[model samples]
Target: MRIYLYLIAGITSALIGWNIGQFFLTDLGLFSSFPELILYPCIAISLAIGMVLNEIFISSPTRPKLCLKKAKFPVLIALGLGLIIGLFSGAIAQILFLPFFGIPAVIVRIVGWLLIGVAVGLAEGLTWRWETVEAGDKKRFLHRLIASIGGAMGASFLAAILFEVVRVFLQEMPKNLRLAEDPIGFSVLGLFLGLTFSLTSSPSYLVALRAGSGFEYVSQIFAQISPESINLSKDYPRIDQSVLTFVSDSSLDRIEEGLSIKLPSKGSFKIGSNNDCHIYIPSLPDHVATIEIKSREAILIPHVLYFNHIAINGEDLKTKKNIVLKHNYLVTFYSILKGENNSENTIIINHEKIFRFVYYNRFFDPQG
Candidate 1:
């Protein structure tokens, strides 16, 4: 289903660009070489934009919090590459001039479009590479770059071949009096281009949550509070049990545990007392905090209501809107009602519900 969507988007973009170029060609027919000058550029620009949009659409579900500001450079790269490849293709085709070099025009056009696909892939790969480079790991840079670029080129090559096959069939069809068959080949090329790219691109990241060093404190408190424990339901049976024990002096006998969950790599997730939140903490207020896990770092944004009670590494987040979470950072969400003084310097009365997790930069694999 998703492959179909990509194909449809790709094909539609190509045909639309081609038709728009044709419209311009007909409207401004003063020069004989206008079609040659205008048509390929239009197609290249459209394909470039289409490929980028397709990549975004495919990646948006997993990377919902991707910042456009950060993507400006890569988008420009893809557009530039696409235009250059298109012009190069046109020039090569004209210079070679169909069988002058003993190679077919179709082959030259295929190679040209192939390079365009490579451009799109290279842009996407660079975008992924750029995000990970900020994490200070240069070891995997070359490997990742090769993987992304290689996958895109491979997919584009396959798409080009498939498009050529389809074009052959289209060419044999009866002369079209109404609709031109030229756009059909472009549509086919676009369709396969998107589908193949999707297949070849890296898999989306899966967030990993394990018992961090801070969990030792919580674990010790849990052991001291209750000697005997009853079993609880596990939300995701595949992963390790993520248990959050709510221990109080008065409620030692009734130590309740909430279902712990691993956050998805999708950038933004709401965590609160609300049942609908990604992570539910009973002591925290409804919609207490938002966690945005990007390619480089994880950020925690506490709701204004629980500003005084929440603290990261003993420092209260009173005036701050969000904090970038580092490895072993203890994000303590204190119970507001049970606190003695809710001031920034003073600690809350019951601070046991601490979210202690390690942020692993390696968890986000651009190659995969």
Candidate 2:
């Protein structure tokens, strides 16, 4: 069902983009001479639109951050292979059919459409295959190549049918209309090519794969934490503010006043007099404090701050403090003489984990 929906969305977006391109070309009076050229941009635009809509409406909850950085090499290779196959096939088709049909102009046009469709399909298919399928030996490469070629052929056939339909429609248009000329034919042809391109675009496949894999990872993490059972919505933290402050030894002068800080779900930050700390608090012992913020809560591990008369929420921190930070929290450091340090401490909250939990829970465990 999801696959069908994705296909429908892609086709619809391609048709819309095709009409838009045609309108532009007709309005600008550039449709007659360079009708085939419009297909390039139309196809690109349609594919982008389809992908974005699918990501936003169809598969947003499970979507993951695509590792585009790692996929660049495979994408480039796919593009190159697709171009080569398209050019070679197009050249052969033109050579074989031009003389047999004895219509140079028509043969050239058809060959161009075939080239665009096949090339776009193969490129997109290969890229998607690489991302969805695991990387393996040369056998996997052969399988991917075959699948990509088959997709390209299917796209080319569909494009051919669409081109004939549009061509027939244009032929039936009123003779007095300006669009009844070659512009109409070419515009329809461009639309056909665009549809073909959208049918095999890689964006939807990659997005869906990434999203599904991300959900699996999240589930694994949750399972590891608690095998019996866990309530993600209840356990996750919903932070409203995230701020951190640094206090110096001097009561009158603060080395650094206050700065907003952001923490990831699973990371640690250190603050001390040494340069190794994320925030340096001068006049305090080296590595005086450490903060570990997880998806559930934040832990403050005080080293020398325990004895330095550091106070959290008016309570002296004689030991480590496990703060259940909500909307707001404050931490202040004081000297032995009960004088407040110049550094300021503030808390910043993040609700990404909580939101993720709620979204998943709503869809996956509604009864729970």
Each model's lDDT: 0.56, 0.43
lDDT for each residue of candidate 2 in 15-132, tens digit (9 for 90 to 100): 6655766676777765445544554445434543343334233323334344343346554654454446544644554454545767655456555555655554455444543443
What C-alpha lDDT, on a 0 to 100 scale, does residue 352 get in candidate 2?
22
| Poorest stretch of ten by lDDT in candidate 1 | 244-253
lDDT of 1 by residue, 1-368 (tens): 55776777778878877887787778766233635445665676676666665555454435644635444665676667667766666566566654558887667766766665666556555555434322133434455556656765676677677767766776677778224656866676677666765565433323433334222323545755774652233321122123222111111212223212335555677666676665555555667777787775678887776676667777777664888777446566665354445665543435654644443333332211
TM-score of each: 0.51, 0.36
Candidate 1 residue spans exceeding 4 A from truth? 1-5, 30-37, 56-66, 130-141, 177-179, 210-368
Error of 1 at 184 (Å): 2.1
Backbone clash pairs in model 2 (N, Cα, C under 3 Å; residues 3+ apart or in different chains), count:
11
RMSD of each: 14.9, 18.1
Q: Judged by lDDT against the true structure, how good is candidate 1?
A: 0.56
